[model samples]
Target: AQTVTQSQPEMSVQEAETVTLSCTYDTSESDYYLFWYKQPPSRQMILVIRQEAYKQQNATENRFSVNFQKAAKSFSLKISDSQLGDAAMYFCAYVGVGQFYFGTGTSLTVIP
Candidate 1:
Protein backbone atom coordinates (compact mmCIF):
# COMPACT_ATOMS: atom_id res chain seq x y z
CA ALA A 1 0.00 0.00 0.00
CA GLN A 2 1.11 3.56 -0.79
CA THR A 3 0.34 6.64 1.23
CA VAL A 4 1.09 10.37 1.15
CA THR A 5 2.06 12.27 4.29
CA GLN A 6 1.89 15.96 4.91
CA SER A 7 3.53 16.94 8.14
CA GLN A 8 2.37 20.55 8.16
CA PRO A 9 -1.23 20.98 9.12
CA GLU A 10 -1.14 24.72 8.35
CA MET A 11 1.13 27.25 6.71
CA SER A 12 1.09 31.04 6.38
CA VAL A 13 3.03 33.38 4.12
CA GLN A 14 3.18 37.12 3.63
CA GLU A 15 2.09 38.68 0.38
CA ALA A 16 4.64 38.21 -2.41
CA GLU A 17 6.69 35.96 -0.19
CA THR A 18 7.60 32.33 -0.53
CA VAL A 19 6.69 29.23 1.45
CA THR A 20 7.60 25.57 1.25
CA LEU A 21 5.29 22.71 2.24
CA SER A 22 6.86 19.50 3.40
CA CYS A 23 5.64 16.08 2.26
CA THR A 24 6.70 12.44 2.44
CA TYR A 25 5.35 9.16 1.24
CA ASP A 26 5.69 5.41 1.51
CA THR A 27 5.21 3.29 -1.56
CA SER A 28 6.42 -0.03 -2.88
CA GLU A 29 5.65 0.82 -6.46
CA SER A 30 8.67 2.26 -8.21
CA ASP A 31 6.91 3.87 -11.14
CA TYR A 32 4.29 6.31 -10.05
CA TYR A 33 3.38 10.00 -10.03
CA LEU A 34 3.25 12.72 -7.38
CA PHE A 35 1.04 15.77 -7.47
CA TRP A 36 0.13 18.85 -5.52
CA TYR A 37 -3.42 20.02 -5.72
CA LYS A 38 -4.83 23.25 -4.37
CA GLN A 39 -8.41 23.60 -3.26
CA PRO A 40 -9.62 27.08 -2.61
CA PRO A 41 -12.61 27.94 -0.46
CA SER A 42 -14.68 27.09 -3.55
CA ARG A 43 -13.46 23.49 -3.30
CA GLN A 44 -12.08 23.21 -6.80
CA MET A 45 -9.16 20.90 -7.35
CA ILE A 46 -6.31 22.65 -9.15
CA LEU A 47 -3.16 20.92 -10.27
CA VAL A 48 -0.20 22.79 -8.84
CA ILE A 49 2.52 20.57 -10.26
CA ARG A 50 3.58 17.01 -10.90
CA GLN A 51 6.74 14.93 -10.91
CA GLU A 52 7.39 11.60 -12.52
CA ALA A 53 9.18 8.89 -10.59
CA TYR A 54 11.74 8.32 -13.35
CA LYS A 55 12.49 11.97 -13.89
CA GLN A 56 15.59 13.22 -12.19
CA GLN A 57 14.95 16.90 -12.75
CA ASN A 58 12.52 18.60 -10.39
CA ALA A 59 9.29 19.77 -11.92
CA THR A 60 8.49 23.48 -11.97
CA GLU A 61 5.55 25.64 -12.93
CA ASN A 62 6.06 29.37 -12.86
CA ARG A 63 6.14 30.13 -9.14
CA PHE A 64 5.77 26.53 -8.09
CA SER A 65 8.50 23.91 -7.95
CA VAL A 66 9.02 20.49 -6.43
CA ASN A 67 11.99 18.94 -4.73
CA PHE A 68 11.52 15.27 -5.53
CA GLN A 69 13.72 12.87 -3.65
CA LYS A 70 12.87 9.47 -5.02
CA ALA A 71 15.06 7.53 -2.65
CA ALA A 72 13.67 9.29 0.36
CA LYS A 73 10.12 8.98 -1.00
CA SER A 74 9.60 12.70 -0.50
CA PHE A 75 8.15 15.47 -2.60
CA SER A 76 7.86 19.03 -1.35
CA LEU A 77 6.07 22.00 -2.87
CA LYS A 78 7.51 25.51 -2.91
CA ILE A 79 5.36 28.49 -3.63
CA SER A 80 7.14 31.72 -4.54
CA ASP A 81 5.75 35.22 -4.80
CA SER A 82 2.52 34.11 -3.26
CA GLN A 83 -0.46 36.41 -3.25
CA LEU A 84 -3.67 36.76 -1.28
CA GLY A 85 -5.41 34.58 -3.82
CA ASP A 86 -3.05 31.76 -2.95
CA ALA A 87 -4.86 31.22 0.30
CA ALA A 88 -6.22 27.71 0.03
CA MET A 89 -5.88 24.15 1.19
CA TYR A 90 -2.84 22.53 -0.39
CA PHE A 91 -2.82 18.78 -0.69
CA CYS A 92 -0.10 16.33 -1.61
CA ALA A 93 -1.42 13.47 -3.64
CA TYR A 94 -0.33 10.26 -5.36
CA VAL A 95 -1.74 8.90 -8.59
CA GLY A 96 -1.74 5.30 -9.65
CA VAL A 97 -4.08 2.83 -11.40
CA GLY A 98 -7.49 4.23 -10.65
CA GLN A 99 -7.80 7.18 -8.27
CA PHE A 100 -5.59 9.52 -6.32
CA TYR A 101 -4.70 9.37 -2.65
CA PHE A 102 -4.58 12.79 -1.00
CA GLY A 103 -3.03 13.95 2.18
CA THR A 104 -4.91 15.35 5.18
CA GLY A 105 -4.21 18.83 3.73
CA THR A 106 -2.43 22.00 4.77
CA SER A 107 -4.36 25.23 5.08
CA LEU A 108 -2.35 28.02 3.51
CA THR A 109 -2.90 31.56 4.78
CA VAL A 110 -1.68 34.53 2.83
CA ILE A 111 -1.02 37.51 5.07
CA PRO A 112 -1.42 40.89 3.51
Candidate 2:
Protein backbone atom coordinates (compact mmCIF):
# COMPACT_ATOMS: atom_id res chain seq x y z
CA ALA A 1 0.00 0.00 0.00
CA GLN A 2 1.19 3.50 -0.79
CA THR A 3 -0.08 6.78 0.52
CA VAL A 4 0.96 10.43 0.21
CA THR A 5 0.44 13.07 2.83
CA GLN A 6 0.67 16.85 2.67
CA SER A 7 0.66 18.32 6.14
CA GLN A 8 -0.05 21.87 5.08
CA PRO A 9 -3.41 22.47 3.46
CA GLU A 10 -2.74 26.11 2.64
CA MET A 11 0.35 28.24 2.21
CA SER A 12 1.03 31.82 1.24
CA VAL A 13 4.17 33.37 -0.15
CA GLN A 14 4.97 36.87 -1.23
CA GLU A 15 5.84 37.51 -4.81
CA ALA A 16 9.47 36.85 -5.67
CA GLU A 17 9.87 34.92 -2.43
CA THR A 18 10.22 31.24 -1.77
CA VAL A 19 8.07 28.55 -0.17
CA THR A 20 8.43 24.91 0.59
CA LEU A 21 5.56 22.41 0.55
CA SER A 22 6.01 19.34 2.65
CA CYS A 23 5.07 15.78 1.75
CA THR A 24 5.48 12.37 3.26
CA TYR A 25 4.60 8.92 2.06
CA ASP A 26 4.15 5.41 3.33
CA THR A 27 5.08 2.59 1.04
CA SER A 28 6.60 -0.84 1.16
CA GLU A 29 7.88 -0.79 -2.38
CA SER A 30 11.57 -0.24 -2.77
CA ASP A 31 11.42 1.24 -6.25
CA TYR A 32 9.05 4.08 -7.01
CA TYR A 33 8.64 7.57 -8.33
CA LEU A 34 7.58 10.68 -6.47
CA PHE A 35 6.09 13.72 -8.11
CA TRP A 36 4.76 17.19 -7.46
CA TYR A 37 1.90 18.46 -9.56
CA LYS A 38 0.29 21.87 -9.78
CA GLN A 39 -3.35 22.44 -10.67
CA PRO A 40 -4.43 26.01 -11.21
CA PRO A 41 -7.91 27.42 -11.58
CA SER A 42 -8.01 25.85 -15.00
CA ARG A 43 -8.02 22.46 -13.21
CA GLN A 44 -5.27 21.11 -15.34
CA MET A 45 -2.68 18.97 -13.61
CA ILE A 46 0.80 20.11 -14.57
CA LEU A 47 3.83 18.16 -13.62
CA VAL A 48 6.11 20.40 -11.62
CA ILE A 49 8.92 17.98 -10.84
CA ARG A 50 9.72 14.37 -10.10
CA GLN A 51 12.16 12.24 -8.13
CA GLU A 52 13.23 8.69 -8.69
CA ALA A 53 13.63 6.55 -5.64
CA TYR A 54 16.92 5.12 -6.93
CA LYS A 55 18.47 8.57 -7.34
CA GLN A 56 20.24 10.17 -4.44
CA GLN A 57 20.25 13.60 -5.98
CA ASN A 58 17.11 15.65 -5.68
CA ALA A 59 15.29 16.68 -8.84
CA THR A 60 15.03 20.31 -9.88
CA GLU A 61 13.21 22.03 -12.69
CA ASN A 62 13.68 25.74 -13.21
CA ARG A 63 12.81 27.44 -9.91
CA PHE A 64 11.25 24.24 -8.55
CA SER A 65 13.17 21.64 -6.61
CA VAL A 66 12.49 18.65 -4.43
CA ASN A 67 14.08 17.30 -1.30
CA PHE A 68 13.58 13.57 -1.55
CA GLN A 69 14.53 11.45 1.43
CA LYS A 70 13.82 7.87 0.61
CA ALA A 71 14.73 6.50 3.99
CA ALA A 72 12.47 8.92 5.77
CA LYS A 73 9.78 8.60 3.14
CA SER A 74 9.79 12.34 2.67
CA PHE A 75 9.45 14.32 -0.55
CA SER A 76 9.09 18.07 -0.35
CA LEU A 77 8.75 20.74 -3.04
CA LYS A 78 10.41 24.14 -2.93
CA ILE A 79 9.31 26.99 -5.11
CA SER A 80 11.80 29.78 -5.52
CA ASP A 81 11.06 33.30 -6.74
CA SER A 82 7.36 32.62 -6.54
CA GLN A 83 5.20 34.57 -8.92
CA LEU A 84 1.47 35.27 -8.95
CA GLY A 85 1.23 32.75 -11.71
CA ASP A 86 2.57 30.12 -9.36
CA ALA A 87 -0.48 30.22 -7.16
CA ALA A 88 -2.28 26.94 -7.43
CA MET A 89 -3.19 23.63 -5.80
CA TYR A 90 -0.06 21.57 -5.32
CA PHE A 91 -0.35 17.83 -4.96
CA CYS A 92 2.23 15.26 -3.95
CA ALA A 93 2.05 11.93 -5.64
CA TYR A 94 3.64 8.50 -5.50
CA VAL A 95 3.71 5.76 -8.08
CA GLY A 96 4.78 2.29 -7.12
CA VAL A 97 3.77 -1.32 -7.64
CA GLY A 98 1.32 -0.28 -10.30
CA GLN A 99 -0.50 1.95 -7.84
CA PHE A 100 -0.79 5.72 -7.76
CA TYR A 101 -1.36 7.75 -4.62
CA PHE A 102 -2.03 11.46 -4.26
CA GLY A 103 -2.09 13.83 -1.35
CA THR A 104 -5.01 16.03 -0.44
CA GLY A 105 -3.17 19.02 -1.96
CA THR A 106 -1.88 22.34 -0.70
CA SER A 107 -3.32 25.57 -1.98
CA LEU A 108 -0.64 28.17 -2.55
CA THR A 109 -1.46 31.86 -2.55
CA VAL A 110 0.93 34.44 -3.87
CA ILE A 111 0.74 37.79 -2.16
CA PRO A 112 1.67 40.81 -4.18
Candidate 3:
Protein backbone atom coordinates (compact mmCIF):
# COMPACT_ATOMS: atom_id res chain seq x y z
CA ALA A 1 0.00 0.00 0.00
CA GLN A 2 1.24 3.51 -0.78
CA THR A 3 0.99 5.94 2.11
CA VAL A 4 1.95 9.58 2.64
CA THR A 5 3.20 10.95 5.93
CA GLN A 6 3.51 14.52 7.06
CA SER A 7 5.46 14.72 10.31
CA GLN A 8 4.73 18.35 10.98
CA PRO A 9 1.30 19.03 12.40
CA GLU A 10 1.58 22.76 12.05
CA MET A 11 3.76 25.44 10.47
CA SER A 12 3.95 29.22 10.45
CA VAL A 13 5.53 31.68 8.06
CA GLN A 14 6.04 35.40 8.25
CA GLU A 15 4.40 37.42 5.57
CA ALA A 16 6.99 38.06 2.83
CA GLU A 17 9.18 35.19 4.11
CA THR A 18 9.39 31.57 3.13
CA VAL A 19 8.21 28.31 4.67
CA THR A 20 8.93 24.71 3.84
CA LEU A 21 6.62 21.80 4.69
CA SER A 22 8.08 18.32 4.91
CA CYS A 23 6.58 15.06 3.70
CA THR A 24 7.63 11.46 3.12
CA TYR A 25 5.95 8.39 1.77
CA ASP A 26 6.20 4.63 1.41
CA THR A 27 5.31 3.11 -1.89
CA SER A 28 6.05 -0.08 -3.77
CA GLU A 29 5.25 1.26 -7.23
CA SER A 30 8.10 2.92 -9.14
CA ASP A 31 5.91 5.34 -11.01
CA TYR A 32 3.45 7.57 -9.23
CA TYR A 33 2.57 11.23 -8.65
CA LEU A 34 2.83 13.58 -5.69
CA PHE A 35 0.83 16.70 -5.01
CA TRP A 36 0.42 19.58 -2.60
CA TYR A 37 -3.09 20.80 -1.87
CA LYS A 38 -4.14 23.93 -0.08
CA GLN A 39 -7.47 24.06 1.80
CA PRO A 40 -8.39 27.47 3.06
CA PRO A 41 -11.18 28.44 5.43
CA SER A 42 -13.51 28.15 2.47
CA ARG A 43 -12.73 24.43 2.49
CA GLN A 44 -11.84 24.16 -1.16
CA MET A 45 -8.93 21.95 -2.13
CA ILE A 46 -6.61 23.84 -4.46
CA LEU A 47 -3.59 22.43 -6.26
CA VAL A 48 -0.54 24.31 -5.15
CA ILE A 49 2.04 22.23 -7.00
CA ARG A 50 2.86 18.78 -8.28
CA GLN A 51 5.80 16.54 -9.21
CA GLU A 52 5.84 13.69 -11.64
CA ALA A 53 8.00 10.70 -10.75
CA TYR A 54 9.80 10.63 -14.11
CA LYS A 55 11.10 14.17 -13.70
CA GLN A 56 14.44 14.64 -12.03
CA GLN A 57 14.26 18.39 -11.65
CA ASN A 58 12.01 19.82 -8.96
CA ALA A 59 8.77 21.53 -9.95
CA THR A 60 8.13 25.20 -9.39
CA GLU A 61 5.15 27.51 -9.82
CA ASN A 62 5.66 31.13 -9.00
CA ARG A 63 6.22 31.16 -5.22
CA PHE A 64 5.70 27.42 -4.89
CA SER A 65 8.31 24.72 -5.43
CA VAL A 66 8.93 21.10 -4.48
CA ASN A 67 11.97 19.18 -3.34
CA PHE A 68 11.29 15.74 -4.75
CA GLN A 69 13.68 13.05 -3.60
CA LYS A 70 12.50 9.89 -5.28
CA ALA A 71 15.14 7.71 -3.67
CA ALA A 72 14.16 8.84 -0.20
CA LYS A 73 10.46 8.97 -1.07
CA SER A 74 10.37 12.53 0.15
CA PHE A 75 8.48 15.49 -1.29
CA SER A 76 8.43 18.88 0.33
CA LEU A 77 6.76 22.18 -0.53
CA LYS A 78 8.38 25.60 -0.23
CA ILE A 79 6.26 28.72 -0.13
CA SER A 80 8.05 32.01 -0.73
CA ASP A 81 6.94 35.59 -0.10
CA SER A 82 4.12 34.28 2.00
CA GLN A 83 0.95 36.25 2.39
CA LEU A 84 -2.07 36.18 4.66
CA GLY A 85 -3.94 34.52 1.84
CA ASP A 86 -1.47 31.67 2.05
CA ALA A 87 -2.64 30.74 5.51
CA ALA A 88 -4.39 27.39 5.22
CA MET A 89 -4.17 23.68 5.74
CA TYR A 90 -1.61 22.01 3.49
CA PHE A 91 -1.73 18.37 2.55
CA CYS A 92 0.74 16.09 0.81
CA ALA A 93 -0.91 13.43 -1.28
CA TYR A 94 -0.16 10.50 -3.54
CA VAL A 95 -2.24 9.98 -6.65
CA GLY A 96 -2.99 6.44 -7.71
CA VAL A 97 -5.78 3.86 -7.86
CA GLY A 98 -7.88 6.59 -9.46
CA GLN A 99 -7.90 8.54 -6.19
CA PHE A 100 -5.72 10.40 -3.72
CA TYR A 101 -4.41 9.47 -0.29
CA PHE A 102 -3.74 12.51 1.84
CA GLY A 103 -1.52 13.21 4.80
CA THR A 104 -2.90 14.31 8.16
CA GLY A 105 -2.50 17.91 6.96
CA THR A 106 -0.47 20.86 8.27
CA SER A 107 -1.98 24.13 9.34
CA LEU A 108 0.03 27.13 8.16
CA THR A 109 -0.44 30.46 9.85
CA VAL A 110 1.07 33.53 8.27
CA ILE A 111 2.20 36.16 10.75
CA PRO A 112 2.30 39.67 9.50
Candidate 4:
Protein backbone atom coordinates (compact mmCIF):
# COMPACT_ATOMS: atom_id res chain seq x y z
CA ALA A 1 0.00 0.00 0.00
CA GLN A 2 1.08 3.51 -0.75
CA THR A 3 0.30 6.63 1.21
CA VAL A 4 0.70 10.33 0.53
CA THR A 5 1.46 12.65 3.41
CA GLN A 6 1.14 16.42 3.57
CA SER A 7 2.52 17.95 6.74
CA GLN A 8 1.12 21.35 6.10
CA PRO A 9 -2.60 21.51 6.70
CA GLU A 10 -2.85 25.08 5.49
CA MET A 11 -0.63 27.68 3.89
CA SER A 12 -0.92 31.39 3.24
CA VAL A 13 0.87 33.63 0.77
CA GLN A 14 0.60 37.22 -0.24
CA GLU A 15 -0.18 38.14 -3.80
CA ALA A 16 2.90 38.12 -6.05
CA GLU A 17 4.80 36.03 -3.53
CA THR A 18 6.05 32.49 -3.71
CA VAL A 19 4.94 29.52 -1.62
CA THR A 20 6.12 25.97 -1.41
CA LEU A 21 3.96 23.07 -0.25
CA SER A 22 5.56 19.86 0.92
CA CYS A 23 4.48 16.31 0.19
CA THR A 24 5.95 12.94 0.99
CA TYR A 25 4.90 9.43 0.03
CA ASP A 26 5.65 5.85 0.92
CA THR A 27 5.71 3.29 -1.85
CA SER A 28 7.37 -0.03 -2.51
CA GLU A 29 6.92 -0.02 -6.28
CA SER A 30 9.57 1.51 -8.44
CA ASP A 31 7.24 2.50 -11.22
CA TYR A 32 4.80 5.20 -10.26
CA TYR A 33 3.52 8.69 -10.90
CA LEU A 34 3.02 11.67 -8.63
CA PHE A 35 0.64 14.54 -9.13
CA TRP A 36 -0.50 17.77 -7.58
CA TYR A 37 -4.14 18.67 -7.96
CA LYS A 38 -5.93 21.83 -6.94
CA GLN A 39 -9.58 22.08 -5.97
CA PRO A 40 -11.20 25.42 -5.57
CA PRO A 41 -14.30 26.03 -3.48
CA SER A 42 -16.29 24.85 -6.52
CA ARG A 43 -14.98 21.29 -5.96
CA GLN A 44 -13.37 20.80 -9.35
CA MET A 45 -10.00 19.05 -9.21
CA ILE A 46 -7.47 20.49 -11.64
CA LEU A 47 -4.13 18.90 -12.39
CA VAL A 48 -1.43 21.32 -11.39
CA ILE A 49 1.67 19.26 -12.11
CA ARG A 50 2.89 15.71 -12.62
CA GLN A 51 6.16 13.83 -12.27
CA GLU A 52 7.10 10.46 -13.61
CA ALA A 53 9.21 8.27 -11.38
CA TYR A 54 11.55 7.47 -14.26
CA LYS A 55 12.12 11.07 -15.20
CA GLN A 56 14.95 13.05 -13.68
CA GLN A 57 13.77 16.45 -14.75
CA ASN A 58 11.07 18.00 -12.61
CA ALA A 59 7.85 19.09 -14.29
CA THR A 60 6.91 22.74 -14.59
CA GLU A 61 4.04 24.73 -16.04
CA ASN A 62 3.71 28.50 -16.09
CA ARG A 63 4.04 29.63 -12.45
CA PHE A 64 3.78 26.09 -11.13
CA SER A 65 6.71 23.75 -10.56
CA VAL A 66 7.53 20.61 -8.64
CA ASN A 67 10.61 19.45 -6.79
CA PHE A 68 10.71 15.69 -7.09
CA GLN A 69 13.20 13.82 -4.93
CA LYS A 70 12.82 10.19 -5.84
CA ALA A 71 15.20 8.80 -3.27
CA ALA A 72 13.61 10.77 -0.48
CA LYS A 73 10.11 10.10 -1.73
CA SER A 74 9.42 13.80 -1.54
CA PHE A 75 7.52 15.94 -4.02
CA SER A 76 6.95 19.59 -3.31
CA LEU A 77 4.98 22.16 -5.27
CA LYS A 78 6.23 25.70 -5.75
CA ILE A 79 3.90 28.48 -6.76
CA SER A 80 5.61 31.59 -8.09
CA ASP A 81 4.15 35.05 -7.96
CA SER A 82 0.89 33.62 -6.79
CA GLN A 83 -2.40 35.39 -7.37
CA LEU A 84 -5.56 35.71 -5.35
CA GLY A 85 -7.20 33.27 -7.70
CA ASP A 86 -4.68 30.64 -6.66
CA ALA A 87 -6.35 30.16 -3.30
CA ALA A 88 -7.60 26.61 -3.11
CA MET A 89 -7.12 23.18 -1.62
CA TYR A 90 -4.13 21.28 -2.96
CA PHE A 91 -3.83 17.53 -2.97
CA CYS A 92 -0.81 15.30 -3.49
CA ALA A 93 -1.54 12.05 -5.24
CA TYR A 94 0.38 8.86 -5.90
CA VAL A 95 -0.34 6.12 -8.40
CA GLY A 96 1.63 2.92 -8.17
CA VAL A 97 0.96 -0.54 -9.48
CA GLY A 98 -2.74 -1.15 -8.79
CA GLN A 99 -3.26 1.41 -6.09
CA PHE A 100 -3.95 5.12 -5.94
CA TYR A 101 -3.51 7.33 -2.90
CA PHE A 102 -4.24 10.94 -2.06
CA GLY A 103 -3.07 13.10 0.80
CA THR A 104 -5.41 14.71 3.32
CA GLY A 105 -4.91 18.00 1.42
CA THR A 106 -3.47 21.42 2.14
CA SER A 107 -5.57 24.54 1.91
CA LEU A 108 -3.79 27.52 0.35
CA THR A 109 -5.01 31.05 0.96
CA VAL A 110 -3.64 33.90 -1.08
CA ILE A 111 -3.99 37.26 0.63
CA PRO A 112 -4.24 40.45 -1.37
lDDT (Cα atoms) of all candidates against the true structure: 0.94, 0.95, 0.95, 0.96
Model 4 global lDDT (CA atoms, 0 to 1): 0.96
Q: Considering summed lDDT, which 10 consecutive residues are worst modelled in model 3?
A: 93-102
Q: Cα deviation of 108 in candidate 2 (Å)? A: 0.2
Give the runs in model 4 whose Cα sits over 4 Å from its true position: none
For candidate 4, which ten residues in a row score worst on lDDT?
92-101
List model 2 lDDT by residue over 1-112, tens digit each.
6789999999999999999999999988888999999999999999999899999999999999999998999999999999999999999999987777999999999999
**Candidate 4 or 3, higher lDDT:** 4
How do all models score by TM-score? 0.97, 0.98, 0.97, 0.97
Q: At residue 18, what lDDT does model 1 achieve? A: 98
Candidate 4 lDDT over 1-112, as tens digits, reads: 7889999999999999999999999988889999999999999999998999999999999999999999999999999999999999999999987667999999999999
Residue pairs in clash, model 2: none
What candidate 2 gets wrong by more than 4 Å, as runs, is none
Regions of model 1 farther than 4 Å from truth: none
TM-score of 4: 0.97
Clashes per candidate (backbone, < 3 Å): 0, 0, 0, 0
